[model samples]
Target: MGGLSDRFWNGAAAQLVNAIIAAVNARDFDALERYATADLLFCDSRGGQISGLARVIDWLRDVIAADPSFALQVDAVTSSNGSALVTGTTVSRFFPEARRTLWRLTFSGGRVSEWRRYSADPLPVPPPLTAH
Candidate 1:
């Protein structure tokens, strides 16, 4: 938690991330219901922002049309308290480029309050500790 919010975020948050990812991959955004707060916010790496679930849905539909083959695969998840940093790859048959992606997610009351996509994975996971 790092003493951030009082909210508890861990495995459940990861699962929510995965579910959202799946919905995006399938282009079935209706599945995202109940996963986001009423005032959800979504932003792209380029600084474009979409507020509210309805706006987010419109933006996602546009994304799907522009990049039909774009897909995200989660490589790792680091979460604490109400925040999670997701590292993943985005590969598209249309683009044919393997790009590293970072998804920053914040949860509140078991639902996503904010989501941001970054073009790079900034925080590398540290090595595990050995017995002293």
Candidate 2:
């Protein structure tokens, strides 16, 4: 049963990762909004202070707009206790560099309640953000 639960959770995490990559790459704000909790919290290592769903949406929009060259591809996903860890790599169109990243996500009512992004390789920073 534990294995079953683990597989289920890991699968869910992978699904969410796919949706996130697709939504963000496609610039589909509606999909992103639908997958989020009203009080969704995104904490990246980039160093910033913010709250509210609108702010999150704006932050995402800003990131997408600021770095069109950035792309993320999930390599693996593992989950336990309603939390999932995603191992991925960030690729860029213009730059020849690829950076590894790990994302931790907690779920509430099937939506992402909290999201944390960490740099796996080096320099734990997200793509780019325009200060608002």
The candidate that achieves the highest lDDT relative to the unseen native structure: 1
User: TM per model?
Assistant: 0.78, 0.80
Candidate 2 structure quality by residue, lDDT tens digits, 90-116: 776534588878888788888888887
What pairs collide in candidate 1?
A: none
Q: Candidate 2, residue 48: CA error in Å?
A: 2.7
Number of backbone clashes in candidate 1? 0
Clash statistics: count for each candidate: 0, 0
Candidate 1 segments whose C-alpha is farther than 4 A from its true place: 1-8, 120-132
lDDT of 1 at 30: 77
lDDT of 1 by residue, 61-111 (tens): 765676677678998888886788999987765444678888899998888
By TM-score, how accurate is candidate 2? Answer: 0.80
